[model samples]
Structures are given as C-alpha cells and as structure tokens.
Target: MSFTLGLIINPFAGLGGSVALKGSDGADTVARALELGAQPRAQLRALTALEALKGLTFRLITWGGDMGELVAREAGFEPEVIGRQQGAVSTAGDTETAAMAMVEAGADLILFAGGDGTARNVCATLGTSCPVLGIPAGVKIHSGVYAITPGAAGEIAAMLIRGELVALDSGEVRDIDEEAFRAGQVRARYYGELLVPSEPRYVQHVKNGAREDEALVLDDIAADFEESMESGVRYIMGSGSTVAAIMDHLGIPNTLLGVDVIEDGELIASDCTARDLLTLTQGCAARIVITPIGGQGHLIGRGNQQLSPELLNRLGRSAFHVVATKTKLKLLAGRPLLIDSGDSAVDQALSGLVAVHTGYRDQVLYRIG
Candidate 1:
C-alpha cells in the first residue's frame, strides 16, 4: 500500500549557499540569490527526486509559492497548498502553521527542506505523530532527522511508501542560540525530541561518534586540521568536533558545539551578527573553514545562517575551506560529497573532488557537494 507524504519548503531556507550574506531569510538576500542564479535551488532537489518516482503512487500535501506546492507541481506531486494566497511570501510563523495543517490533514510523513531550526519548528508542533524529514536546506542542521542529501530524502520516503518496513527512531533537535553562537559563544541547549523515522533505505544517523573510542580512527584528519591551523592559515571552524580538533591544538577555547570565526589565534567574530560578520570579513580576507555534519556531508549554509548571501559572495565559490575527517568521509564510502547549496543548481555544481588544503602546504582533493 502506498502512503501520503506532506512536503513543506521554507522558501527562504538556506538561500545564501556560498554567498556571504550570512543567510537567505532577509528580503534583500532572497532577491540576490535570484539575481545570482539561485532561484531554483530550494525547489529543484525535491522536485527532481519526486518526479523521478516514475511509477509510484503517493499523495503529497504542501504549501504554495516558494514552499513545496510550487515545486511539487513542477515535480508533478500536485500537492494541496496550505492557506490562501497571502501575496506569495511566508514568515517562519506561517511555516509552523502550515506544518500544523499538514499534520492534521493526516500526512504519514512530513518532509521539508531546511536546516535544524526548521526541523525544530515542525517537531515542536507535530512531535512524533508525523515523522519529519529534511531536504538538507538551512545553515546548521544539528538535528538527526535530515536526510544525508536532498535526493536521499525523496528516495527514502518513496521506499517507505513502497512497503518498506521502516523502523521508527528518535532524532535529535538541537537549538543553538544564534545570538550567542555568533558571539564566539555556544549557548546551545537542547530544545526537545524529534520524530525520526528509520527506513534503513532512507537515512542513517550517527554524529561522527563524539567520544574517544570512535575518534582513534580519525586522528589523521584531525591532525590535518591542526597542521593547517599552525601554518597561520585562517580557519573558519564549522560546527563539529572535527573542526574543533584544530582549536583544541591551538589551546583556544572554541565554541565546541557552535560556529565561531578565528584569525591568527584571535577570535574576530564570536557569536556575531550578519552585519558584524560582514564587518569582520571586510578588513581581512577570510577563508570559510567548515566540516561536514558527519553523516550529512554538507559544507555550507548549515547551522551558520550568519554567513548571509552578500557575505557568501564575498567568500565566493573558490574561497571556501571544507575539512572533513577521513572517518566521516568513509561514511559515504564512494559517493560524491553532497550539497543542497540552498540553491539546487549550485548544489549540483558542488559535486566532485574539489581542491582543499589539508596541511603542510600540502593539498588534497576532497569530494564535496
């Protein structure tokens, strides 16, 4: 028997991609992504994956406009958009309301495109009754509910609908204080539990093993981060212990569990503002030092919305520094590192082995999205 799925797209989710504006939630930044050829990023991944379901018969419920309705239609899901046409823009509050509607409407699985924050919003309302899946959009996805990649979300959901006896799992929904996280601080506290559906065919959840036991196998990659840092090469530490390894070696108190920016052993912007992040980058040239979210393999626009579009552009496509431990990379085995890119097209471009400096003026090609 087939199942029905609810899809919601946080229209403004992860719009910054590799741009420098901190995030894509603001009006100006949304316009900028469109101007810079990113209007389709949010829609394409879900659409293409849905459309690829050649013979599957499943129902979809979604929101109109920049949300999933428009993308679903293009993907041929023909979803029932939530609410009336309210001039084509939706707020975070509206997103929450729409999710409520989908849950009440009896969606078996609620799939959405966004980062950890969006997942939290849905979990707060729906809990575990309707399992939520993420399309890998937003800046930081600390939660365990999101698919490893956008296509993986659709592919897994389809498997479930096709009679795959999936197990139910509990996913983590972490909330980082954006204000505090940007201030070189991590006031991150757990919001609560999230519904994690386990269709072994869909996504797997393990956070690069946060202890010394799993870490022994990853010392080489951690070593790589340290050698690079000592060379005085700027480090844009992403939100994970892999990146934190460098900070540990430096003896600097890093955020440990949040995003922080450091230059020449000094914290320039800690838990900073989008404006402040821009200010921090203006005087000095910076390289975005980031590590993928273990199982997710994401490089940009996750858990760090402060790097809005304008600022992302300042960092540009080439200036990004993606660092991942060999153990984390092994999770994918042979798949190219995936990227939602916040914009589908760029996310597509994000595939393949790109150049990255590992350490000791030695560079290595790491596959990324």
Candidate 2:
C-alpha cells in the first residue's frame, strides 16, 4: 500500500505579481495584469515540486485540467482526477471544492501551489483534516504555510513520502489587503493554520536522512522476474514501464513500446508483432510479463493491441505475469484493472482476482474486470 498525495494548482495564482499589479485577486486586476503581459507561473512552480518525487511511490489525486492534472501529468504522474470547475475561469470555489474532494478520497497529505489567497481557500475548506504543503508562487506570500521556495516544498514532500522523521506542525495562513498596500498601508489578517511537515531528518543509525531509496523496489521486481525464468522457456515481454524495468535489471535491450522475445535471460527478438508472437511461442513453453497502464488500470488493450483475443487465448492466464508498483495500483482507488482483449470469452476467462507482482517476494490480489 502507498500514501495518497492530493494536488491542487491555482492556474492563475501569481499572474499579477510580475506586471506590478500587486496581487491577482479580483477579475479586473487579473485582466489588467494579462493586458500588461504577465505570464502565469503557478503551474510551472507546481511542476518543479513534483519532479523531486521522481522514482518515489505515492498515489496522486487532483482536480481535472489546470487545477492539477496538467502539471501532474507533466511530472510523469497519473493522478486520479476529481471535481469540476464551476466557472469558465478557475475561482477560489474550485480550490475549495478540490480540497474537500481530496479529503473524501482519503488523501494523507495535500500539496498545493499558489499564494496567500490560494492558501486561504484551501484552509477554509480543509481546516486541519490533513496535512498540506504550499509552493511559493504568488507575489504576496505572507502565508507561513508556503515554503521559502518551490524546490523546498518538493523536498519536504519527498521526505514525507520516504517516511523520514518530519514533525507535523500548524502553519499560519495570512494575507494582506492589496488595496491598502497600494495606498502605503499594511493590513494583514490571519485566516487560520494548517498542518504542515517541518524539520526533516533521519532516524538513528540510518544514513542519508534514512531514506530507503524506494526506487530500488524496481530492482526487487526485476529480481523476481528473473527468478521466474526457466531453462528454454520463452518469455514474451510486454509493453509498459514495469516490464522495461525488468529488462533493465537483466541488462538486456528492450523495445519499450513494443513486445520482445527472450529466453535464458537473453533477448531473442525485438519489437515483435501479433503474428510474430503466435509464431514464436508455438509448440514452446512460453510466458508473458505485462503491466497495466497507470491511472486507467487497463491490463490489456489501450496500447497493447498486439495482444489480440486469439493471442491471449493461446497464452492463457497461467502464462501471464502481471507486474506493477503498489503505488500505481493504489491510484486506481479500488477500481478493478480492466482487460479488453476484444473477445468476450477471452475477457471472461481473464476476469476475477489475480496475483499482481509488486516487488521482490511481494504480491497483491487485484480484480481484473
């Protein structure tokens, strides 16, 4: 199992900051700032934070479109998208709605991007229900909830995901009156505090912040795949990142987006087609190593079209080795992994619970719908 990280990016959070508009709160100010050629940087700031989590495992949940989905995908994450924008332009309402949805989805933490206004919106919706970290992207970052820099926010999130000794404390969310600021007066109001992670370090006797380098779990999965190899038994390596990891561990060439043939830990053929698969596995003891598409959870179809119904029938379920990271599987949120082999009989036979290889000597029972 993996922890769920909720994400929300205020697409227009810092639009007015660069154009000397003070802040981007009202619609008129945003329009004026845009006319002055101010570019939006909130999404880019969020992307920077997400990139630090590369090779780590966590379930990502976010709102559809610019609120979070676009940046999440850009960071190589297949986040579970939820909620809808109620207006043409994303408003504070959207942020509040997204925060509420994150809580309902059982998010262990919510990582948001934007300024003090965005922080206020999230604070109003979530209170202290779950921990949150803020990326500094707005012009007036008076909020204590925000990290000093976007990179710091990402590093803190990576520490939390790695199970480091990080203390959770309440951080104040404060915002100033932009109008008063233009008149040479300062008026800051406290919205409330949110749970945030602070003081990241490692436990005793552990080195490097005690971070386990969870990325090595791929090596474990690959080891398990190698152990399953038999003498002269042909293995049809399928398309997907998980299988690619196995090939990497074996130190062999792999056509990442295509099928391959291997035997005795050596690559026999590269980029095999449907017809090629049937011909190669005929009259031979063969097995397949496959993985589901992240987020969609499609075990078959949706890219592996080469695995036709006839081919699946010939291979049978016993010949299949389903592999995936627990983080990827958990992102499906209990929804069954899908199998669309294009044959009703083949699909039915492939249905029901199946053991998914998650790591070395680790397996989880998941349904193939």
After superposing candidate 1 on the true structure, give the runs of residues whose Cα lies further than 4 Å from its correct spot.
Answer: 21-40, 85-88, 200-369
Q: Give the alpha carbon lDDT tens digit for every residue of 1-369 in model 2.
A: 797899998888767644445578888888987887667778887887887899999999999899999899998999898786888889998899999999999998898988889989999998887999887667566566766446667888888889887887887787888787544354678899888876422100000111134468888999988887899999989876678889989999987656789999889887765667778888999988899766556676433545656778987888889998887777677867776443547878988888899999999999986
The deviation in Å at residue 91 for candidate 1 is: 1.6
* Candidate achieving the largest TM-score: 1
How does candidate 1 score on lDDT?
A: 0.64
- Error (Å) of candidate 2 at residue 91 is 0.5
Query: In model 2, which regions exceed 4 Å deviation?
Result: 200-369
Each model's lDDT comes to 0.64, 0.77
**Per-residue lDDT of model 1, residues 1-369, tens digit only:** 447788888876666543333345556767885675543355665675575455788877787777776787777556676663355676667778888898888788888887666777787787777777777776556677877767778777777788777777888776556545435454545667667667544464534434444454345555665555543444556656666776676666776545567877777555444565677677566777666666655565455545555666666657677765455566756555554444445555545677654443445587664
Q: How well does candidate 1 score on lDDT at residue 330? A: 65
